[model samples]
Target: MAGSVSPRFARWLAFAGWALVGAGYAFGVLSLMSIGVFVLAGSVVLTLLVRRAWGRGGIAGLVSGLGLPVLYVAYLNRGGPGWVCTTSGPAMSCTDAWNPWPWLAVGVAFVAGGIALQLRRPAAAG
Candidate 1:
């Protein structure tokens, strides 16, 4: 996929991901979450960069971007996002988000699929 897709585009994506990672790490560390959303996005971008650099399975790049976070969040929550629809009281209303495991699973699937698709095809086939 390297020649198939413009190298400029791939390099740009890689640069964007790495750049975001740097910025997010700088400011995001101060937040309560210990990490910022930008950093996560950056990780995904990095993965995409690797995929792009390898020259194949462009879709996997996006899929990995989605999967990495899903897996991370799932790991943090220890399975899912925890209890949803939390009714605290009039003072405050809190609700948990959906489980990341499902999304993570889907991401893993896509990543694997992308890898499989990008496998070196026989030159004879061409």
Candidate 2:
């Protein structure tokens, strides 16, 4: 396994996969519980892909993990400075969800955790 690819790289990929999926849940695009299930499922799939295809798992994980958050952010901000509520009861304002500082902090935490795990080599050995 380590003959063709570095274990450190593999771990980084796995961590990236987990992070991507985690961010999606964190931002509410995907429910928190759903993300938990995705992590378990993604682990098995990524393990198999890493074992057989070398860098494919990492690439996929990177794409999905990183892509989802970007997409979600774009979607959320599409209307610009306002909250689009799907539920009816009381009207929700942009202030309810458009706080830049807190969201930025949350994003930093998610990306930082991913990078830290990658640096720590958590996904080594397929």
Candidate 3:
């Protein structure tokens, strides 16, 4: 089926989505993150609506689209050991932290889903 969403446009959308996501994390801005997610989701939906939704281009677009949320959560739960200490003229303070297993698990799930999408059979073109 003919579509307004060209492969080049879809690719650009994916690139923009990832860029916004990365910038959001770098700047710690929720608004950027939210917009990035919506853009990425839109790219995937548009890809699916056009001809050959399961084709190589579409599959690549979908996998990259999924990366948007994956990047979001990755930043949210940047799992790593954490600790803080402060001292000022005999005054001291310390805080302990632990790794975010749950969030990391969610990231893994997103990755797996993307991989599965990549392996999907392409639909026969009309």
Candidate 4:
């Protein structure tokens, strides 16, 4: 079975996928839910579509797929130049918007890693 993904990696991937799904729903971030679904579904689709030859490249493909939506959502929520305001009985305060740069950086890194993984050849089997 050349290029078959290991069972261990598959199990870990499944666990990560479910965790993402749970976290997304728990945190009320629907975009995360979407990404989780994509990961899970992509795994299955790749498994069937690529069969034995999917290998690490398939994992990389999923990582790439996972990144796109994250980038999109992060971009949308990147926040504008303004103060987030709050008030209480003759008192008022304001703060800057939640920064999306961290998320964007992470997304970019993951995307780059995925692409790099795909470009690199798999290690030789023992």
Candidate 5:
């Protein structure tokens, strides 16, 4: 065994998550924020499973799981991004999305840290 779960189980879990995410988007059963949450949670779970199969990398999952919430909270605090504006033949429209650069930087840091943890080896005792 590698860490906690088997590779076949992980693969099946991923397949199920993909189907669930597809259904959520296609059916509009989930709002934008809900979709985001679902995707992030899926990402964390899948990454942890893969890392576990990779052996002794499960600890890094904690850091990896932190990526989304940190960035999201930062975006919320920054009031998200200003609306996008477009004009055509005197018609105008606008839309918005969170585009916080600093938040992204922090989120990447957490993700990178998790990857680093997975790469590190535990010390051997004499």
Candidate 6:
């Protein structure tokens, strides 16, 4: 399967993962942004690891790019909050939105994905 995947595809996946993270951050969803950054960074590391092991990098990128969104949605469903400017803002209570599970989940996912990619077997040579 590794031999069947193209390096270019992997690079694109990595690029997409980073792009999602940047977009999430730019939107001011701090938790999501943090998740994105973590995932993006992990994707980069995975790319490097894969490159070194298989003479290419990107499987992690692809997995991350596809997985982050799913995880993000899951986190949201589990009560992820929207960005709030201040505790004083109407309809924005810090206590209600301050749950740490989302962040933890994202971090764990990023780390797990990175570790998995790093440990994966090298792609078979053509």
Best by TM-score: 4
Q: Which residue pairs in candidate 5 collide?
A: none
Weakest ten-residue segment in model 4 by summed lDDT: 18-27
* Model 1 spans > 4 angstroms off: 1-62, 79-81, 84-97, 120-126
Q: Write the per-residue lDDT of candidate 6 for residues 1-126, one digit (tens) a residue.
A: 255767655555444554344333333344454565665565566546545553433344443444455455556545535443445545655423445466557756764675466446364321
- Cα miss at 11, model 3 (Å)? 11
Clashes of each: 2, 2, 0, 0, 0, 1
For residue 68, what is the lDDT in candidate 6?
50
Candidate 4 global TM-score:
0.44
lDDT of 3 by residue, 18-56 (tens): 433333333233345457566545544554444243233
TM-score for every candidate vs. truth?
Answer: 0.35, 0.42, 0.35, 0.44, 0.39, 0.30
Better of 1 and 2 by lDDT: 2
Cα lDDT tens digits for candidate 5, 1-126? 434766555443433343333333322322345566666566556555554543332445455445645555556546447776678998997667466777778767875776566446343200
Model 1 error, position 9 (Å): 22
Expressed as tens digits, the lDDT of each residue in 2-120 for candidate 1 is 46656556544543343333333333433428556666566557556654554332433343343444445555554346565434565554455667767567656654553453233
Q: In model 6, what is the error at residue 9, expressed in angstroms? A: 14
Model 3: how far is 126 from its true place, Å?
A: 12
> What clash pairs does model 3 have?
none
Q: Which runs of model 6 end up more than 4 angstroms from their true locations?
A: 1-57, 66-95, 123-126
Q: How many backbone clashes are present in model 3? A: 0
The TM-score, computed over Cα atoms with residue i paired to residue i, of candidate 3 is 0.35
| All-Cα superposition RMSD per candidate | 10.8, 8.1, 8.6, 10.6, 9.2, 11.0
Cα displacement (angstroms), candidate 4, residue 126, comes to 18
Assess candidate 6 and give its TM-score to the true structure. 0.30
Tens digits of per-residue lDDT, candidate 4, 14-122, equal 4344333333332234444556556555545544544344333334544555565566656755663455677999999776755677768867876677656644634
